[model samples]
Target chain A: MSSPLAKPQIIAHIQKSLNYTVFDSKWIPCSAKFVCLGNFARGTGVMQIYEVQHGEAQLVKEVEKPKPIKCGTYGATSLQQRHIATGDFDGNLNIWNLESPEVAVYSAKAHKEIINCIDGVGGLGIGDGAPEIATGSRDGTVKIWDPRQRDTPVANMEPIEGETKRDCWTVAFGHAFNDQDRCVCAGYDNGDIKLFDLRNMSLRWETNIKNGVCCVEFDRKDINMNKLVATSLEGKFHVFDLRTQHSTKGFASVSEKAHKSTIWQVKHLPQNRDIFMTAGGAGNLHLWKYEYPAQRSKKDSDGVDVGVAGTVNLLQNVTLSTQPIASLDWSPDKQGLCVCSSFDQCVRVLIVTKLNVV
Target chain B: MTAEEFVSLQNQGAVIDYNGKVPVEHLDYGYIEKCKDVKYLEKILKVLRSGEEGIYPDLISFCETRLELLDPKNRLLITDKPVTTAASLSKDEWGQIVDDLKMWQEESKKTEDSLKHQPLLNDIIKENIPPIRGSNQSVDIQQKQNKNHCKRPLPRDYQEWDKFDVEKECEQIDSNSSTTSDTPAIVNTGLSKLRTTLDASFLAEREQLNLATREKDKGNEAFRAKDYEEAIAYYSRSISILPTIIAHNNRAQAEIKLKHWNNAMKDCQRVLKMEPGNIKALLRRATVYTNTGRFETAAEDLRTVLKQEPQNPAALKLLSETELKLQDEGMIKKKRKGKKILIEEVDGDDGHNEKRQGGLKGEIFWVLYIINHLSHNLYNT
Candidate 1:
């Protein structure tokens, strides 16, 4: 792997023991620092700043709150600000400045229950749109926040009156090709995945994957809708080609059972969107690369254009932990460098060698 | 054919070079002046790892020194001698070791104030340490070298601290501050109310018990998978939250698998302390005693188990083995020492073998169900 002739190697580089249940980990953009969000045994939410220097993760800052944090994202804020927006068990959304995390820079009562997942886009110059954060919560609502407009979310997708509320598990933003062309995709516990167009304020696409959806991610958030991958409570994960949507069929998809247990997460490489990784409940990480189908769009029986599903090739697989790996984040500054947190209360820094060659 | 298709390479000004993409934050000329955020500066330090010896030489180093003088921990000093940077951090780094070293230094300083004697100063003075290594070496080679022996901070007065009762200390601190405060009465009332509000934790005592049981179940899962270390950790967590006899017994059984004789004995003793008549605990403790060459204690535990249940084959088999061991030591009279125990004479003596292939990784644990006879070979998941 070092010489690039061998297969990509997933090496567990460094591991730091944490005293809390880390629900999420994310790399700070253009930097070596990464943030860990989790709750202590006594249920106090903790945000820790770990700067990776010389293959070591240094805990530079730490802050505690009354509520346990479940999810966090750096997508909504620019590198200069480098603010971390988090969702806690109390269903409150907070953006914090790492320097002084005693109080949130921005806070809002996002939901009635816990916010399970969150994503941010239009920041750091990746996408051409207003910087925004999307949060999916146990309250069965997916909301989008523009930090400039504090107190309330700019957009909220919720269950209709009299309809049963399905807990929202994950959410992501994509299709930000221009200033006003962004979209948010949300996954629910009822196996339903919904993509809401922010510009139109309507559902662009929705599908059910037979099990509670655990995660939904777009390969690239800055471009027009290209591809999306959704993992579920079961071992199944589906990749949808979003470039074309038929009149009847939403988007062509290819499903694969990658893990023996729940598929916890899927992270697309920041530099190469074609390459991605899936973390399994059995503590295994499966690196995959998506091969575009020979044709992206084809005519259906009634002559309507339908999308073609791509084939996902398993590039590499490594079991670096024993417990379920809860979360993993790829670093933006360097390729193949990533951080993963497991149920065992340890955060391991892993380097996937030979990713660029693949 | 190759020459016919050749074309001159031209630089396309229209294309945005993704490789050279600079962050939007760096575009601002007044960023350094406006950027008061410490995290952002940390990132910049990462990008330019050697700001200490930059193009402008002392410009970056001057500011960094002032920053470190501002905060000692931020300086990331490798030893007593102050180093400006973690040495061009472009190699295999260890964050936890550095943090632990800093903590040890603080601890040493506190001790230094209490006692004017310094113990480790000689070692520190003798050891010629390089704060940073060259970044040219490949990571793999550096990691191998690090494994052999690497730089770690050793304070002048380092000693192992005694075990602390974290929960007791926390409670003591809480009570001490509240009693001294003007609103001591309100603080007492506030805790009970807060319990009802924070449903993120167990609602009541019953719920906490249930949570502990759930953790025990998780420990059982790890044990069934033959992950003894993780099982011990989970069982320890369960005990810290709420101790249960079953959790203790299961922990002992798991400890026995890992040959943690002392820990297994301790867990068994804890269980026996709570329930003297606990058949499972007695049998597990006997197993530990036999393994640790305590035949007398093992025979006693086995005798107690046989007294409780005459038809218990596992205990009977273990007792027979212990009796032979004792007889060999000339300590106890063994009536069945010479008799070869036939498997047909004892029912369920085959040692309850269960192959659990349920859920993602099934068959956690049951106190009454699977016992520790499978000590020879724990079924691999």
Candidate 2:
């Protein structure tokens, strides 16, 4: 609902409690349905599909497996298929068909330990390239998978044989402007964010924010490199200007501290790139807007060019549940519509009123 | 547009009165559309049209766009022309500029041959440019453009997503032999060669096997507690998960204890087909046949069991009973005097030994399970 004379507001549209402990939730594209991923108390991974019907979340389908699910992505699947690729506690990657869901569409043993985060690109008509999924796991590796290939990842990023492996916590795909231009940003628990160039199969840029990174996301998946927002385990979040990267220094970034606790997730509004909402560990949601600076790049010392950082302003803040909100996603087709999962075992549908005006 | 509507919306807690004041110009399009008063729009349109052209250019265009939908005649006159200026001008110069504008528009229309690829309808106005998705640049739009075929299925199955041959991929793994640490060697799904590889399908298979074994153990537990019906049910569940000769034989033994002679016979046939000349299956089937009064077949099965294991006391005792029944039924000539002595000796400890055999029957499930497990290990090696 729009409050035309008033400013935009965040409204809790629907809240439903689940039996299992929810770890992640995502909105399915072009539909009113969303998927909730979690583990039952008895150690079974449960994937529950719910559709928003009559202002209520209706259970559409439920599937269970032997492992606990950690993360999932729809970016590697076409709109017609509507498959979900998920990572589980057993280090197994499985793509499921929502229709039958009795067997996986494709499966692979992608890692030796739990997979922490997964992102995908080149699907849903978003990118003009091969649809590939990138998964970062506790095994200290980032692997890219193509559903066309069975049982093996198409690309992998890892350390040398004997080096101590840092746990990879989050991953996201950006700069997918065309078939040849794609990059994967993987955040590790050791405060490192590595930008891997998929076309060249090399690490392009990397830097640490001095705190464990909890989540990373691009403003839009189809456009050229523009902005990336990452939240930390501490009460800090950084917004990086992906348009420019200096030779010695990495991309310029602006950091902000809020919520006074862990910032669990940061999701940009699907209809507006400049606006994003961060879910906090103390059961609060803070909305922020990024304002571009006058000049994006200028000559630094020694006549070398360096990038400029933008400023962020808080739009609103509200407390919903008294537990950490682990995952949040804005609906692809509906502006200001979102679904979030929290440690309170609740999945909530929210309407951030008047996102267009924001 | 209306004071009453504004007050109602304000009371509804959506809009707030800033410092207890309301401004007409600050109200957005959604609020105005909700009011749906045409006179309110008309009043604003009249004021915009009468104002200075440059000062109200945006409002002038907005009013024309909205009003043209209500009046089609005004639409023809509102085509692509700049708003008329209000400043005083000499008649001759104004006429000259007007004629120049018309001539340029006519020349552009006549010179259409210069613009190739006419399908791209580019608007001269910068604000009228369509979004990238509307420009047929995205992949899905291009696909939908050329499609004259039937629609793809909704919520496609995984098999519909790609034409990937899984067995062929495994075969390629065999030929290439490019084994990296993380890139596992994916073997054929049906082949037991999957045991050494930590493939996901193999893990899924092992998970099923563990569940089946658990069911089998529960069946054995039920059998120990003298719940033959529940034991048969659990055995059936285990068989449904993964068919094993041991499970069938165990189920057959339970069915025989329940006096389900026909079901026991069917289960024994299954075990025998899986492992031909199996001594336990032969003995169980002979017992079933003897219970059902098929003395000839029982004798034949017992004879086969004795040939495999001569010290099989259960088979020997059953054989003597079968022969005695055959003799009573007149199906056998009672002329072998040595056979009679052997039968008498086999029947000597019949009552006490039968109870001992029945006690040993309970251990067969564990023994068969261990044997099957060992055979599996041997196969993997």
Candidate 3:
């Protein structure tokens, strides 16, 4: 076969030994610094900030916590603040100001069970909306909290009485640009995907993927609604077209098998809307691109308009270690630079080149 | 539904009466008022849909009432619906829309089935897409291939490769010309060329070594004369021709005399990369680190040197000096923290009594006394 037009090159720049099970890693916006949250051998969580200097990951600060941190994000705060919001195993949500590492600037008891996932939106001064945080918990609830309000959630979605509660696995905020028309997409262990419109206070849409949804993310948060990707436990992920909504059929989606094992997490490149990366339970990372259709919607046999979904093309795949990659985050400032934490007790800094070709 | 039927249904609490209509007396006043208000909106919408002008006052009132009704509670319920201004599309335009819709559906179906049997696309499409190269494949493959090719045996005898012998060919040409030409001028130029060629070949190794040694000697003479700049130039010339440990060492010494710490450090680092156990390079780099305020790195280098030669007095003294510098830095940091705490405590007491001037003086004295005591303890340690 002939070679492709533009092939990406993945360079493993640095690999640092954390000596602990790393759960999550995130890059600070507009900076070359990143924070890795892990659990030490003595059962304490540690958040360490490292700066990239001359191709070396130099440890700048380390903060120890009483509980294991499950996830973290800086998407809820401004770049100037550089506050890291983290959800721990104890269901407590804490936002730490890196400048003052002694205590959490904001702490709230968020859930009755372990907080499975956390995502933030409208921060970094990108949109006109107020900064909000969404937390998905094992208590079968997804709550949206405006950071300006302390100890209370602005909107909460819980299973109705007598309905069996399932573990809410992941939550993400989307469509929060311009005018505060925001939506929260949450995935549950029961293969349920719910998109709740924050502006209307209603369930915009819901579907069952028939497998435990591990992660769900929108292509971009600034647009009204473009695309939503949800990965499940059976090595399959579905990308839904959100532009056209049918009264009976909802959004059109296409499912593809990936990872050959449970897909753990998926992160879209901050620089390109079409490119994304998925971390697998079998210790593999795959780069993919979503090819858009020429037309976004079509009229069905019943004369009802239906949405058209794009296809995913796998560009690259590499196995970095034998353990599952727990989390991966792309740098917002740099095009193809990313940092990932795996179950192998190590954090790796990777550079993916030739992204501009796509 | 017609407007009157819609109003009748709404008035009946969204239910139809047994007689297919509601009694007039059972009608809600608010429902009647809302229905009457919506008639004006319906008329304005009809006019707008017809694409007519004039009746600006009616349109303005219609919009004002709609906004007032949707202002507070039903604000989010407002949606932008597509209002058809034109009557209908032409037959060609309708055909085009249908064709586009069909094409879009087909495209969507194709993508939906692209990954039916495999997690990734099939080999044909996958091959069409570019393959991302891993870090292992990013190095120069041509250079590696050339190296491998050089390591392999040639097809014929090495001496039989006449095309590779350019110098030998030049020599043969010179010899032939010298034999053919009998004129003195021609012979002189040819002989000069031959002599230059011979000199070039001879100087390739033996003569260059001698010249480099002479330059080193010149550097030593300049160094003894205290002309450090001239000495450095001579040493650089010797090293550029043929680098030697002595020349680099002398150049580094000259750079030190000039207080060019960075240049001296680079020379020392180059020497260390070549000879890991060179004591002079290690000592020079350690001194450079100390001068640059990198006490920790200096102490590390000094300790490494001491490990090799325990009785080295210079290493031991420099190690102690680095230790003292590190302790002083720590003392300063602790003093700042202590002073901050003392000031906070004094401020808190002052908040209770602003007139406590004597108490403030006493607090200041205690802060100074504690800082001095802490510094003394740190130095003793």
Candidate 4:
């Protein structure tokens, strides 16, 4: 086998120094464009848009807002008409059109504390053509928003107050529906993965994984296989099965000493659902592959052995920087390309490949 | 390319031909303004620009000094760039430009003050500190290596791997499985458990939604029974489950009965933002504004209502009350000409510090008193 222990290839480095720390980044679904948010020099919150043309990243737009931007995600009609949605420290959420370069069409105060993560939740047939948005906040709440209505949230799932209000760190929606069923999962500071079913306003499942859950993702295209992968602060990966009414099954140690800090974000490739990448606070990103157990019985009531239902092997580990990675977002269409933001006040696009052929 | 080469190109481009392509907001204007700490900020800024292009992690340090000079209450208004004159802008456009800038500056300050309250900024600062690499030859070499590290492009496909070995490993796993080692029963248990838990969550969501609807229906029933307070409470509860303009509007009607003008005003404002053309919200806001003595704002809201419904007697009444208030005030048109005083001398008095400290205590006392007064005012309002 080609040695999977290879370093990711760096394509372009964006050298612009943000006056404030960058909180998150998102790739515009189909294009080589990306948007990021941070504090501007004036201490006011600001967002910048960048486009990767040929090989270089050129700054396309910079908009000044009122609060420090904590997280940003891109949404589109079908990966062509791009829109950027940003969550700020003051609970203000703004969704902007990349083409207009003017006022944000959708704006509202969504949370009390900083919005830790903002994800575009697709596959919800909510009548309104506008995409629904999901946001995780330090206030220990996950909210669902529709762009058409700005002031009030469509739905809010707050953690039981008496229990530890673990600040939600990240959120991802599983478009990979099993039998036309989709779900959304949010990772919390206390390492809890709570899946929410949008079709019905209900909590799907909650698990207490020892470490703080930093990132969680479900396979995008593979619908029948209800699989979930969660990365935690303790450098451990937990894969859960939503089909089976039993114990959760998969655990993969991709980078034991690869990152000196907690893993910040993880993303499954849109094109290849089996391949996934995780960004660590130690400025390292590790990729892994899950090989299904061959001896496993045929699809049971617990459903088929999904991609993450068995053993996982580390493929490549690349050192990004010393700065803790704040967030990592993969293009829903692109195969290997990804965008990562960090405390280093930089966002870089990296390419990974096999180091050597066996 | 090396870090040095990258820096030279960036600096050369910045110095010679300004790439207006990089928005003024995105430019590392901090480096330009705070040139005193050139080495540190420059290095950090370089790494950020070359790596991410737009996101900056160390912007807090740059804003620390500026943030100190501003007032917390008025921070949003004060942080505006003291307007500038451009040759491209005509003399007639000056007044509008200055007004626009001032408006945005105030807006920006409000945004900044809100940002200061976020928890993540504090976390980011605590977590992401750039490894302080001092000015050394080795450091320069490392910087070059770091630049190259992030500049590599990602692979497109399975870099068509040497599948021969992977196939062999797969064959090994396949043949070994035939020997029949015990399958981890834990896996099956965990999977089933997950499935059950997921189903429970879906059911719980439906139950919650149903409860919300029930609460909302109860509120409507109370409203129909003419029990305004009970209706308000039920509506509030329903809004907690799912906030809608109708609920807020219903609550506003109850507030009107209770004569809670300010609360009604707030509800009306919220509904207006959600549904701009809401006639009830507009009418209620006009009444609240008039009652609160904000005549101009009251008149504006009433005008909007009247425009939509020309025969709106309620809107006309509110407009008349606002106009009456405006007639009494007669606009304070005398503009205070502030002195352009310049303090060129630096104070050498240590005694000045003592005086300042004394004033600081008094100011603190005043601020505390003001906050308490404001809280009372808010409560009463």
Candidate 5:
């Protein structure tokens, strides 16, 4: 498989001495709107949502959180409703409705330490009602919550060994492919990745990398395959093939030291299953493509596993900033369009030429 | 020279007349070369060799120089003349000839200079020197060294001359006559008008430039306001009057904002094509590259920008970003080990940092703080 080569072009530039520093951002799926959060230095809350327009991005709404917001996500559902969920430094998780332009739909202090990551997927494990949100934090715990019950979490997953806790940096979930319960993946500072099967409330699998894992992402668009990508502090990226039982059969290294500093975030392209983008601590965003090698025979020769694909190649790379890029999300309508927030006090839109790769 | 040639030249209003003849004795070398007719050359020689005892010594010397031209073996040709020469003769012989000619020329000058006081001498001479003819008519020579010696004969018609004398006497009696009153005024006004016309054309050219500058500034201000349509209107108006690069760049920026990508690209390409090394055009093209998803190309533009201005913040930022995106793990590791890559990079800005003093404040302060903290060592040596 050959890596896809893409060219990145900057669309617009805005220079303002913003009151707060950007920590994370998310594109509202299927819409031109997105939300970002940081500290609004003059005593206002950290999270703000800006609507992209023809002239410039405008501050459409701002939500007050208990502490600095580290990450944010949007649930897969309606576009016009403006449902946004955010995790803050104080370990408080909040979801807001931007449709009214100003209303907090859900709020709770969910963790004892800084909340590192938050994600949501509706109409599945929640029994076809409201969307369920998941948050991971430095307190070494992952919590699943439904907005209806504002106080206690629906379920919580902690490490089984009870060893000294490592900060949980990111969390992701996807519905099982063959009548299995939904699995949650959490990445920690100790370079360990833990997956939890919510149906049995038991540990599913664990893997150790050489560096602290900063972000984790499941290929949400891939309905038939079990693939997960993770980015670590040392700029190492890992892709797992969870379809088979062999622990080592599915893993592939995308690249190592791809960024100068920490790898802050990784996201699967919303429309393309084999495409993804990663953010760096040094303020750059790189887009990548993974392709499965062509098979030669009905029965493959690799002895360990029958369905394992060998190596992955990086296709396109783009730098969206000069300061550390903390988070990134792709535009739902455009296959190659992605947005990133950086320490440079700006959000940039990058366009890629080729996202659909074999 | 023919009288008709002089008449024709005068009719065409030629300021400097070439056909006009100068006195044979006073002709300089420059005019002699301009007279190319061989027939007139013979006539001049005949006139020179036929000189009587009272012929001017100046004319005789002029004839001798022309005579030497006949001897090709002597490196001089006939009809070729010299205005002045120093022959290596014994002192007594050359000194006597020089003394005699010097005296004659001085006597002729005195007579000419006093013609205003003794008008009879002007009549006796008709002209101080004899007229030259045909190809030997060297008027430019007379103008160069002997213009003052060439006397023009006063109007020879005796009746008309007497009438001019009588009119002058009458003007003294009736000083209020209209002709007398208006003559000086017309002469003075004509002189002043000529001077003004010469100066006005130069001033007009400068004023045109000033007007163009004012119009351009108006257009530039409109561009700064982000009203691209209005700005374009103003820019077009200014460009029609006088085109400039600043206006072109402004129009290109506005076009990009309107998503007229091709138009913007063409404008930038035009500017750079006209002036390939223009800093502004290069920067504008760099931005266009970024927008078009040509990050590698954009990096080349930024590199050029940096070479010209080493501390250019925009170029540096863009360059670092592009490098980060281009990071392949193997390549990064190879580059880190300092292997020379064959990438053809663009020239960056020169080493002059514009905000050198101002930018160093934060970075320098941090460095100093670290040094101060380190000075207080936990382990006392």
Candidate 6:
């Protein structure tokens, strides 16, 4: 009931020219360097690695591929290796060694169509299990790949023969670090979100938002299942509490209207789990904070413990340009420092001050 | 000064000699008295005592401009009290005041009720329902008749739909058709059976082979598109349907694109077993072996390919690269041995005792060494 806290000030540090339509950006693990993947005017994908130097993004390395890259992640492999796994429009998944950018160290044809999203887990020296990557494609299938196994995927999720195939817009890995158990959460174009358990090889849970879901992300990849934020079309996003599950009602969730247009992506700060930022189709960036309930679960009439959902509070918003922000990444080593790419063919390095206070 | 004297001096517009040596200005007694009631005189006196003479003339003018209203008699006229006589009071005035207060309270209560019960404007405007006419009257009459009718009694005999035998109907149809038909039907049935047997034996294998080729063609299309994963899948499917050297060789190429060294090597091996003269398979297998640190095997494969095609540029280049890699590997081995000997010498004295004492540092050094070695290997590869 009380008014939310005063919004934080977003200070734009440096706006760099990408000269291409940037589709995705990701920060290298344990470094100030970040990678931006974009498409050139000729339709080829270009990956540029930039380092944050004196409030400016300095281009460190650039590699151009024959196909357009849709997404990339650094979570699957170890931080020491610094291998970046990327999915391309040609359905090829490739892992590049940062030291050698001329060619990928590992590559595979991962899907039948363009890969819409990719995520990785069990890396960063946090878990005992081997690192794995999950990719969702426009072909309507989500496949999990262990890089050590080169010939085929470790697991594949496709529609049954009689069922209609839906485009998978996003995929995420969660509940991975502490235990060997891991689950892949995928978002479909039909508003369906499915959580597939890798250990049991079955769909653990599924729910629909009645609107196309664009992106799905777990709060932290190296922790147990804690929270999930899913962004959808029509300017809405939902936060689900994963600590408790009900028999009839699944994980408790609360929906909130974010930007006035579609939210393209939502990324939680690497330093703070409760804080996250959403990039909107209207080129607006909104900072949000999740407030957890004092008691996560309570007994129902049937004596079953039901999860109590938390609330999402808007903290700040800033409009950088007129074009929609396609992708953004927060530096894992530096607090409040982030890089985001927009449809305007420019990548901006921003610093959100006073985030440590939140 | 006395009130009478102050008024007499003000009328004369002259000074009053207080001590014969200094003359003090006469003040308006009425104005002074009015100022005292409002506490303005005390503020003016405080200002005067501070010796700020610049504000004195303004204060004096303010008093003079309002001299008529400041008259004591005029003040008394405006301050008159209401008359206490009963003749001046209105009849039932207290009752009327109470009634008005109650009426106001009731009006506020009505407003509060309206606010609580008011429907949304959109909902109110959207509601439009027409009254039901003759159709409802007929339905009501029918319902009334149905209610008046008595319920039927249960029958003792019961029949189940599942009790009927479906085969008996088919048998009756078959008997009727057979009786009407003759030798032509039997001949047609016999010929169809023979044709089915012949197709099963001769065409099945060829059909499977055709399907495999189709799958292989799909794999080739995917490979051209650079979708090596799909190509690999298609090629695998083709191999599963009917094992062929072409499918295996194609899968190996896709695997090589993916940098699946072990898988590519296995595929190449399968192809070479089918046709030992496959130069493409040999070269691909040699590249895989070179990537996986099997230099000797890679050299052997390159030698075989060079023998088959002496003028092949790809094979020639790969052979030179393999030789350079082998030399580098030899140097790395020598360096590792040198480091191992140095470590051995450092811990040679009281071998068991020194090892226990320096184990932590040694382990840390080994980890750093291994990391450095691995990074170096990665750069060369």
DockQ values per model:
0.01, 0.02, 0.01, 0.02, 0.00, 0.01
Quote the chain B TM-score of every prediction. 0.35, 0.34, 0.35, 0.31, 0.31, 0.38
Q: lDDT per model, in order? A: 0.70, 0.72, 0.70, 0.58, 0.56, 0.70
Docking level of model 5: incorrect
Model 2 segments beyond 4 Å from truth?
A: A1-5, B1-381
TM-score for each model: 0.49, 0.49, 0.49, 0.44, 0.44, 0.48
lDDT of 1 by residue, B42-115 (tens): 44443344443234434345435433554433422211211112342324443543454345335433432432
Mind giving the per-residue lDDT tens digits that candidate 2 earns over A1-358? 2343344566676789999999999987656679999999999999999977655799989999999999999997755466899999989999998788999999999999999999888665454467788888999888888777777777778876687889999999987755576788888888888888776666777788889999999876755566899999888999988766776666889998866689989998765678899999987888888877777666777555677888887766778788899999988665677899999999998766556665
- Encode model 3's per-residue lDDT on B1-381: one tens digit a residue: 899977776754544334343333423334333543343333433444344543455544455455356442122222222211112434674455345434533543343243132243234332332222111111110111221232344586677775577798789879866765422210001111111000112223433454466456556644643456666776776677677777777788788788899888888888888789688778878888888888888888898899899989999998898899889977987777555655665664555354345455656788799999999999999
DockQ of 2: 0.02
**Taking the candidates one at a time, how many backbone clashes does each contain?**
8, 0, 0, 46, 20, 1
Please report the candidate that would top DockQ against the real structure.
4
lDDT of 6 by residue, B39-121 (tens): 23333433443445434655554543343344422221221122122232345743443354345335434433443344433
Off by over 4 Å in 3: A1-5, B1-381
Give per-residue CA lDDT, model 5, range A187-282, as digits (tens): 888888877665456565677886898888887521222468888888778876544444333243344446667888888766554567777776
Please tell me the interface RMSD, in Å, for model 2.
26.8
The positional error of residue A62 in candidate 5, measured at the CA in angstroms, is: 3.2
Q: What TM value does model 1 have?
A: 0.49
Residue A58, model 4: Cα distance from true site in angstroms: 1.2
* Docking verdict class for candidate 1: incorrect
How high is the lDDT of residue A196 in model 6?
80
Off by over 4 Å in 1: A1-5, B1-381
Better model by DockQ: candidate 4 vs candidate 5: 4
